[model samples]
Target: MQAQIEILASLQTVDREIREQTGRKQRLLEDLRVTERQIQAKKGEIDALSAAWSEREKLRVEKDRVFQDEGKKAMDKRMRMSRIKNAKELQALQREIELMRLGNGELEEELIKIMQEIDAIRAQIQTKESEMAAMQEEWQKKQDELQVEINGIDAAVSEASTRRQTIASQVTGDLISRYELIFSRRGGTAVVEVAGGICQGCYMNVPPQLWNEIIRNEKVHLCPSCQRILFVKPATE
Candidate 1:
């Protein structure tokens, strides 16, 4: 019973370490997820800007074509005016030329505005793309480091689990099963010492007989309050 109690104690130590490692791994994974989400958000911003820039570029091209067509029409009308035989026909042609010229001027202004907008959009795209690149590099480094840490944690957890199994095997089957149940129920604290006639697992007072049984170390005893396995440390140890 003394040796069994010692094995249970050792098993508890390993189990606690395993739980801690598991928790650390989970936290690291959550951090990695958050970082990835941020990276995606940055990419989304760049993609939206890129789409806008593309649309603006298309509009600019179409406007330039329209401007060129209007200029050609104006020039053609001026050439036809040189062959006019009537004053009224000449005046009408002149009026048409003036209207076309005015329309072309407005188109020119619109084209200039579109060009300015395109330049602004391009600049924004450039800045955002650069920012995204830097953000990705930074996040990738953090992710790599986190992955390494997670791997270390995994290795530690595996080792602790193996150690737990080895220590648990030295204990009785029924005791080991009960310890597991109590460990889960008691928040990873399945075994605890009796101190000052109190159950250290819950700080509850232990009955005199129970305390004596724990002192005897004859068999596994459970705390009445918390149901955790009770043990007593050797005075020398």
Candidate 2:
């Protein structure tokens, strides 16, 4: 029982290392996920700006078309003036032409404003695209580095698990199962030492009978307070 307890203790040590390594791997993976989300968010920003720029470009095209058609119509009206002979009719036609000219002048100003706005939106799109590219590049490097670290952790965990299995084989199946249960329940401490009639696991007093049994090393004992397996170091020559 004494030697068996020693084997269980060694098994617990390796199991603890495996648990810690697995936890570290999970944290690294979560960090990678967070960075990926940031990259996706950056892409969304660039897409929205591009859509807005496209809409403005469409508006500019329509405004320029209206400006061209209005100029053509005003020119056609001016050609009709040469064909008019009556004084009042000629004067009315001239006034109509003047109104069309003023309307075209207003449209020309609007077209200028639209062009300027399109230029501004294009500039914004360019800036956002550049920023997105840089973010993606940096993320790529970080992702590669994280993946390498995760792989290394995986290899280490695999090796530790093999070692734990070997140590566990030295312990009885019933005891191993019981210890695993306590280990999971007690936050990784399944086996503990008994010293001065006290359970080291919970720092509680051990019953006299249980303390004597622990010292005898004839059977496995448990700490009542923390429910951890108890052992005592045997005296050496």
Candidate 3:
């Protein structure tokens, strides 16, 4: 019975270690996913910026075409004014020319503003694209490294599991079941050493009588407060 209890304690220890490793693996996997999403979001931002720049370029080109057409129309009207002989016709033609010139000036200012905006947009797009590319490369490298780590941890977990199974096989079924029940209810720690007259699992002080019983090591003892199996460590040589 004593040997079986010791075996059960060892199995629980192995199971606890396995749980810790499994938690670490889960966290690493979550980190990998977050990195992937960050990379994807950066790429989407770059794409949206590029699209905006393209649209601005198209608008700038269209504005310049309209400005050129207005200028041409104004010049043609000016040429026609030279052939007019009547005073009334000449004055009216002059007025029309002035109005056309003012319209052209306004169009020119608007076109200049559009060109400046396009230049600014282009610069911004270039910066964002460069940043996105660098981030993607970094993310990919990190993901690959994590994948290698995950594979290594998976192999280790498998080995630990096998070791745990072997340890469990050495214990009686009743003791194994009892340990598992305690572990399930107490966060994977069923057995704890009684050190310095306290349960190491919960740091609770053991009663005088229970402490003495634990020191005998003749049978399995449980902490009344935390319900963890208690064992006494041998004195150091």
Candidate 4:
């Protein structure tokens, strides 16, 4: 029973080491994911800006084409003005020329607006592209640093796992099984020290009879409150 208790204590140490290393690994992994997400978001912004720039350029080209077509139609209408003979026909032609000129002026205004919008979109695209590049570089640097930290943690975890296995091998099968059962249900603390008449695992006072029994160290004991295997340690350093 004493040997079994010693083995349980060793297993507890192993479990604690494993838990600490696992927590660190999880934190590092989360940080890596955050960095990756930041990079992706910046890239998405750049892509959106690029698409907007392309669409604005297309609109500008179509507007220019429309203006040119309108100008050509106005010239053709003027050429036809000299061929009209009747007064009524000449007044109708003059009215048509005035309407065409007004339409051309409206189209020219629209073309200028489109050109301005295209220029603004292009400028925004340039700024976004530069920002994306900087963000990507920062992301890469973070990735490299994170990779190094992850690698170190991986090695530590491997070592801790190996040590756990080694310690587990020294314990009897039944005792190890019982410890694992308690650890799985009780947050990796399957063993507790009995000191000052208290169950350190639960921070509850132990019964005097049981406390005395534990102090003798004749057999392994379990805390009444938490049911963790208890051991007695020397009071002095």
> Among these predicted structures, which one has the highest lDDT?
1
- lDDT tens readout by residue for model 4, 1-237: 667687778878878887887888788788878877877887788788778878878887888888898899889988998987889998988999899999989988888887888788778778877877887788788778888887988898888889888888988657778788888888989998877888889999999999888878776678899999888876787
- Return the TM-score for each candidate structure: 0.83, 0.83, 0.83, 0.82
* Per-model lDDT: 0.89, 0.87, 0.85, 0.83
Question: Deviation in angstroms for 216 in model 1?
Answer: 5.3
10 residues in a row with least lDDT, candidate 4: 1-10
Q: Which 10 consecutive residues of model 3 have the lowest summed lDDT?
A: 1-10
Model 3 per-residue lDDT tens digits across residues 94-202: 9999999999899899988978888887888788778878877887898889889989888989999999989988886577787889999999989888888989999
Steric clash pairs (candidate 2): none
Clash pairs, model 4 backbone: none
Off by over 4 Å in 4: 50-58, 82-91, 216-219, 235-237
RMSD of each: 2.7, 2.8, 2.8, 2.8
Return the number of clashes found in candidate 3: 0
Model 3 lDDT, full chain set: 0.85
Q: Order of candidates by lDDT, top first?
A: 1, 2, 3, 4
Candidate number with the higher lDDT (2 or 3):
2
